[model samples]
Target: MKSKIALLLFFALTAFTLLQNRKITGVVTDEYQKPLAGVMVSVPNTMISTTTDSLGRYTIQVPAYALKLTFVLPHLTTQQIDIGKSNTINVTLKTGRINLTEALADHQTVHRKVSGSYVKMESAPQTFMAPMQRYQPGETENYNPINENGFQVASQMPVTTFSVDVDRAAYSNTRRFLNNGQMPPVDAVRIEEMINYFDYDYAGPSGEHPIAVSTEMTDSPWNPGLKLLHIGLQAKTVPTKNLPASNLVFLIDVSGSMSDQNKLPLLKQAFKLLVDQLRPQDKISIVVYAGAAGEILKPTSGSEKMTIKEALDGLEAGGSTAGGAGIELAYKLAKDNFIKNGNNRVILATDGDFNVGISSEGALQRLIEEKRKEGIFLSIMGFGMGNYKDSHIETLADKGNGNYAYIDNIQEARKEFVQEFGGTLFTIAKDVKIQIEFNPRHVQAYRLIGYENRALKNEEFHDDKKDAGEMGSGHTVTALYEIVPTGAKSPYLSKNDALKYQKTDASDIGKTDEMLTLKIRYKKPDEDQSVLFDMPVKNISRPMAACSENLRFASAVAEFGLLLRGSEFKGKASYRDVIARAKTAFGKDEEGYRSEFVQLVKTAETLDNRKETAQKD
Candidate 1:
C-alpha cells in the first residue's frame, strides 16, 4: 500500500511539471512595418527558440522561469525584450552594416563614426541564430551530380533521346542563392530550367493533338563552327476557372529544423495563398508529420476558408521528422476521398529532412511510385535553406509524375498558385519523350545542351513501360542542341576510324532537304499508350542577329548557366556577352521575368568582380 502511494505521487508530480510550460506567440517586423520573415526568435540563455514565418509570426513553448526573448537575422540588427507579465511580445529591427573585410573573418563587427576619429567599432550583437543557420559548402545541402552531355558522332550514334523537364525550381533556387549574395553550386544550375523560366509566345494547339511544337535553328553564339537548334513545345492551355474539381492533400513537415523562419512560416503563407485561389468545388486535407503523423483537418470544402485559416494559423513546429509515415497517411486520405476523373494530388511541403522512418530516398521514391499508379499525382514545394535536400525532393516529384517548385518568397508562391494556376495543378500530358535522328550526310557531331540525367536510350523511346516526364497545362518546355557541319573540326568530337563491320548508309540521303528528324511521343493523363508525331528540321540556319527572340534569349540563358557552372564546354561565353545578348531579346515585358533574368546576370557579374578583387588583395 505504501509503494502504491509513492507511485501515485510520482505521476501527479509529472503531470504538474508538464502543465508548467506555456505557448507564447508574436510577430516580428522591420522598421518599415512590413512583416520580416526568416527572423530567429529565442529565449535568452536557453535552448528554446523559433523562427518567424512568412507573416513574421512565431510560436515557441516557454517555461515559467524564462524572462527575456531575443531575435536575430542576417542583415538585420538584433533586439531583445523582457517577457514579464505577458505571453506575447512583438519586435521591430533595423538594418545592420555588413563589413566586407570582416565578413570573411571569424568575427563580424558594426562600425560607427566618431566626432574626431575616423572610425569607431562595436562588438557583434548577441544574436539568437542557431549554428545550423550558417551555410557550410557541400555539407548541409544536397544536389544531383551533373555531367554535361558530350558530342556524339552521327555516323556512329545518330539518335538522341531525352525526357522533357518543366520544373523551374532550379532557376528559382539559383536566383535565391544569388540574391543572398553567394554563387550557387554548379549542380543547382539546370540550363533547361533557366531557359524555360520565361514564357514564350508560342502558338497554341489548333489540331487534335494536345501540344503545339515549334523549332528554330541558328548559328551558335558561343562557338563559331557549331549551329544551335532550338525546339519548343506548348501544352494545351486550360483556364483556371474551367479546371476540374481538385482533391488535394497537403503533407507538411513540422520538424524541429522547420522552426526556422523560411521553413514552416513560409510554407504556411504559401499554402494560404494557394487556399485563396481554390474554387468551392475543390476539397483539401492537411496532414502534418513531426516524430509522428496525423491529420489536422478532414476533407474540407474550399469554401470553408475561415476554418482552414484557423487550422493553418494554429500550427507550431517541434520534434523529429517522419516524412515516410506522413506520405503513407496522406496517400491513404487522398485515396479514400478520391475524385474520379478530377484532379487528385498530394502536395508535399518540406525541407526534405526525414530522420525517423523510411528516411532513405530510395524507399520513399518506391512508395511514391507505387501510389502514382493509382491515378494520383504528387507535387513537391521546397522551402528554407542551410539544410535543404534538393536531390531527395526532385527524385520524388519525378517518380510520382508531378512537377516541383522551390518557393523562395511570397512572390514566387503567388506566381505558382495564382498566375500559373492551371499549369501548377493540372496535367495535360504524360510520358512525354523526344527523339532526334541526325543525318550523317550533313552533320558530323552534335551535343545536347543540359538535361544530363533525363537522357534515355534510343530504344526506350518506343517502349510504353518506360517512365518519362509529365507536362502541365499551359507549360512550355524547351531544349537546345549544338550541331557541327560535316568536315568541321571541333575540340569536343574525337576522330574515330570508319566502321569495319558495315558501310555508312546514304540511301535516302538526297531524297529530302531534311537535316534531322524530330519525333515526339506523349500520352493522355489517364492513358497508357502514347501518340506519335514526327517533323523534319530543315537546314535553314540563320545568323544569331537574324534569329527569333526565343532562340537568342534561350541561347543567352544557356550561356549564363555554363558560365556559372564553370563548364569545360563553354566556348567564348562571358558574362558581358550574356548580358548584352539577353538585353536585346527582352521581349514583351508583361510579367517582367525576362527583365529579371537580365538583372540576375548583372548581379552575378558584380559578385564575380568582388571575388576577383578580394583574391588580388
Candidate 2:
C-alpha cells in the first residue's frame, strides 16, 4: 500500500510540473498593422520575459497559472492583458506622452508658445507626466551629441566651415523608432542624413573637377520671413563596370550581445548580398572578433562566392567584444593585400560594443586615426539594437576617413551594396570641405540647418592636413541655411554693442548682388593637397512654390527632423505642413523613396494624435 501511494504522488507531481511549463506565443503591433520590434512582453510579477523579434513575433514559456501579461516600451502606454484560457495573445499598444516631455527637458533653452504667450517651461505644469520606470542596463543606444545650430552674425563670423557628410545611418535608425510606434530621441534625428538619404536631381559634374557645386535661394517654408539657401555637391559618377580593381576586408563582430537573430543572422544575409555583387578581380578577406580577434578566411578572390558564403554561414556568436583588436587585424589584412590605385577598404559590421580591449571612444578613435594614414579607408556598418554604441561607430568612420551606414533589414543591405555599389565602395574625393562666406552686405544673420557635429573652425577651411568628409562616386550632398535678411526685425539676430576697437566698413554693403561666396576644397582619392573652387551666389531668391522639386523635398525632410527633435526654432511647422510640401515635390520617384517619406509623415501624424488623445484621457 505504501509503494502504491509513492508512485501515485510521483505521477501527480510530474503532471503538475509539465502543466507549469506551457509555452505561449504571439505577435505585437501598433494599430496600423505594422510589426513592432523591441516591445517588451512579459508575464506580470515574473522573471519570464522576451522582446519581440524584427517581425514582431515572440514565444515564451509561461506557467499555466499565470494570470496576465504586460507589454511596455518607451513613449508608449503600458498595456496589460488577461491570459485566461488563451494559448496566443496578439496585442496592440497605444502611444503615450512621457517621451516628448523628457525630450523637452533635455533642451534647456527650449520653449513653446501656448495661447500666444511664451511661458517658461521650468514653472509650467507637467502636462505630459507619467509614472517613472527603471530601464534595463543595455536598453539605451548611444548617439552623437546634438545641439541645434543657432544664428551667427555674418559680420561677426563671416566664414561658416564644415565637413561634407554623406552617412545615411541616422535616417534608417529614425525609421526603426517610428516603425515601432515610438518617436525617435532627439539625438537620433540628423537632418543632414535624413535629407541626403534620397537622391536629388542636381546636375552632375561637367568638367575636370571631381565634384560639381550648385546653389539655390528660396523663401523658407517653415518661416516665411526667413530666406533659405540650398547648397549642393554632386560627385562624379563611375560606372560599376568601369570601376577600378578592389581589395576589401570584412570585419565582423560576433559578441555575445549579437546572438539575436536580427544581429548575426541578418548580418550574414547582408554580407551574402555583397558577395553576390563581387567581381572576379576583386579580393575579399574575413576577420571576426568575440573575446578575441582572428582571421576566419584567407584573402580569396571574389569569384569564389561559394567559399565566402560558406565561411559566412559557419559564423556563430559568443563571448564579449574585442572591437579594437578586430579593427587592427582587418586593417593589417587590407594593407597586406593592398591594391595600388584600387579601392582598398576595411568594412566593419558591428553593434559598436567594444567591452574587452581599448573600448573607450578616445582609444578606438586614435587607433582608427592612425590606421587611416596607410591609405586603407574604413567603412562602418551598424547592426542590432540593444546596447548599440552608435557614438563609437560614428567616431570610427568619421576619423578613419570613411562612411557609415546602419543596416536595419535585408532590403537596406541591397540598397547599399547592390544598387549603390559604386557609391558605397569607390571614393572619388577625400577630405572634402565647404566654407561659405556670407556677404555682410546682403545677409544680417544666418544659421545652418544641420551638420552641427561636422562644424570646423574658420582657419581649418584651407588646412589640407585636417581631416574632413569623403565623397563616394555618384554621391550627392545637400545643405540648407536660414538667413535673416538685412534689416529684418527678428528675435534670432544677435544684439551686440558697437565694437570699441574696430570701425564699420560699409563701402561694399550694397554694391554687389552677391548673397554669399561658396568655397569648396577637395582632394583626389589618392592625393594629399586639395584643389579649391569659389563661386559667388547672387541674391536671386524665388518663392517656395516656384523652387525646384529637389529644394522643396529637401526642405520637407528638414522640417520633419525639426519636429521630431522638438526644436524651439520649428516655427509653425507641423506634420500636415510636411505632408503637403512633400506631396508637391514627389516627382519622378521611380524608386518610391519619396512616396515612402509621405507614408512616414502620415504615420507620425497618427502617432502624434494618439499621444494627444492619451494625454486627454
Candidate 3:
C-alpha cells in the first residue's frame, strides 16, 4: 500500500509539471495583417527562441517562471507581451527605417570633411530598411490578409525594388561609337538595362493602397572624389491574401548538351528545393523534352513530394532538344488546368538549345507571343555553360511577357526562389519604362551606362502599348548617369568649325531645372492601360569628392561591370579603386555583400593581370 501511494504521488507531480511547461501557439503578422514569417519569438532572459513558419504561426514551450515573450525582426520594432494563463499569443511587428540624417547629426564629430578639385557630399536624409528585413532566411511574410468571405483579398498597390550597375566608361565608349556612325562593341551591351527595359516584378491589386516610391540619392565611389551618383527607390509590394490556387508546369530540357553536372543535375536540385516551398493548394506538372516532348507527370499537389521526386530522379539526358514541342505541350497542360484568378505559370528550365522543330527564331517567338495572350506567364531559367543560347532565351522571355534568370548554382536558385519569393512569382506592375531628359546647360555630354537594348527613341517614352519590363515585389532597380559639366571640354568630340550645323557663342548656357526630367510609365497588374510619373531634375551639383554612400557603391558596381566586360571605355579605372570605393560606402556591412564585392575585385585583378601577361608573351 505504501509503494502504490508513492507511485501515484509521482504521477500527479509529473502531470502538474507537464502542465506548467505547456507551449503557447499563435501567429505573428505585420501591421497589414500579413503573416510575418521567420520572426524570432523567445523568452527575453532565456536561451529559448523559435521562428515563425510560412503561415506566421509559431509554437514555443516556456518555463513556468517565464513572465513574458518577445518577438523580434531585423529593422522592425520589437514587440513583447506578458505571459498569462492563455496558451496563445499573436504578434505584429512594425517596420522601421534608419535615417541617414539622424545618424549624421548624432555623430557630427566622427564625420570627416575634405575638399578636392571636385566637391563631394554625403547622402541626404536617406531611409532604408536593413537587408535582413528584406531577405531573412526562412522568412515568409504574407502580403495580404484573408477576408471575411473566406477568399484571400488583394492589396491595392504592388511595389518592388531593383538595383543594377553599368560601367560608365563602357557606356561612354558606346555613345562615342554611335556618334561616330559605327556599331558599338558587342561587349558594350548592358544586360541590366535590357533586363530592366521590361517590368517583371509588379503584380496587380490586392485592394489596399496605391504604390508609392521612396527614393534616396548618394554620392558615387564612396570616397572623396564624387564620380558617380547612387539612386535607390523602394515601392510598396502588392498584397495577396489567400492567393488563388496555382498551377505550375515545369518544362525541362534533358538534352545531350545538358548532360553537364551543372546543367540537368543542377536543374533537378533547384526544382527540388522549390518544391519544398510549395503549398498543399499548389499543383505542379513536369514535362520533359529531348528528341520530342512528353508529359512526365500530370498536375499533382505539393503534398506528394515523393511522387515529384521520383519523376525528377528518373529524368535522363539522351536526344536532341525539341524546345518548341515541349513548350507547346506545357502550355496545353497549363490551359487545361487554368486556375481562375490564380497564378498560372510555365517555368522552362534549359540550356536554350532548340535543335528540333520550329528551330527558327522567328517561329519560336511567334509561338510564345500567341500563348502570352492566354494569361499564362512564362519564366526562363537558363542552366549549363558552354554553347548556352542567351539570345534565344532572352527573346523567348521577352515575347512571352516573362522574365529570364541565369542560375549559376544552388545559391542563386535560393536567392531567386526562397529569398525573393514574391518578386519571382508575382507580378505587381508591368510595362515599366524610364526616360531621362538631360539639360544641355547642366551637362555637356551625358551617357546612360548599360541598357543598350532597353534604350527607346525619345518618342517611345509616351507610347503605352509598347511592352516594357515588369517589376516584382521587393526588388530594387537603380540607374546611374555620368555628366560632363557644361563648360567641360569634350575629350572625344573635336572642334569642327567647318560643319554647317555648328553654332558658336553658346557658352552662357547654365544649369536649369529642365536640365533633366525622369519619366516612368507602368501598368496596373491586371490592366492594359498605363500610368505615367515624372520628376524634374534640379541643379544640385556637389563636388565629385563629396559624393554620397549610394553614389560610391553604385559607381564601384558599374566600374566592376565595365572591367568584367572589357569595354574600351575603361580608361582610368583600376580594380583597387573599385575595392576602395566599395569599402568606403559599406556603412553597416549587414549582409557582407560589400566584402564579397572586394573579393570579386581581387579575382578580376588576377584574371586581368594574367590576360595582360599572356598578351605580352
lDDT of 1 by residue, 1-617 (tens): 99999999999987788658778889887766767665667766554666675577888887777777777754445677888888788898765533222322322222222331112233322222232233556667888999888889998898999999988899988887776678898898888878877777778899998989999998888888888999999999988878889999999998877776567766777898788888899999999998899999999999997788788876778788999999999999999999988899999999887888899888988898888888899999998888898988888999988989998766577678867888988999999999999988788889999988789999999998888988888999989999988778888887699787744555535656688999999999888899999988887888789878888899999999998998888999899999899888988654456766877787788898998999999
- Best prediction by TM-score: 1
Q: After superposition, how far is residue 409 of candidate 1 from its true place, in Å?
A: 1.0
lDDT of 2 by residue, 1-617 (tens): 99999999999998897567667789987655656655667665544566665466778777777788777654456677888787899988655532433322322221233432223356322111111222233497898889889998877777899999999999987776675567777898999999999888889999889899888889888886889999889999998888988999999998777765457766887898799889999999999998899999999998999999999988878788898889889989999999999999999999888898777778878778887877899999998775778888888899988899988765577668877888888999999999999887778889999999899998998888899999999999999999988767777765877456643354545689898889999999888999999888998998888898989999999999999898978888999999999999988765456776877777788888898999999
Error of 1 at 155 (Å): 1.1
Candidate 2 — which residues are off by over 4 angstroms?
1-138, 500-510
Give the per-residue lDDT of model 3 (tens digit) for 1-617: 99999999999998787557668999987666767655667775444566665567888888787788877653345677998889989887765422222322212221122221111124312111111111222432111111111100001001111222111122322222222223333553353432232222233333332334323333333222222333444345644344456789999998787765557756776787678777888999999998899999999998898899889978877688898899999999999999877778899999787889779989888777777667788888877544566667766776666666766544445545666666676666666777655555554545455555455665665676566676666555666654444455534334434225433223533434554556667776667787877676565756444755655666777777666555554557779988887787766543333554565466557656776898999
Q: Which regions in candidate 1 have their CA more than 4 angstroms from the true location?
A: 1-139, 505-508, 614-617
- lDDT value for candidate 2? 0.81
lDDT of each: 0.82, 0.81, 0.59
Clashes in candidate 3: how many? 58
Report residue 95 deviation for candidate 3 (angstroms). 30
Error of 3 at 522 (Å): 0.7
Error of 2 at 535 (Å): 0.6
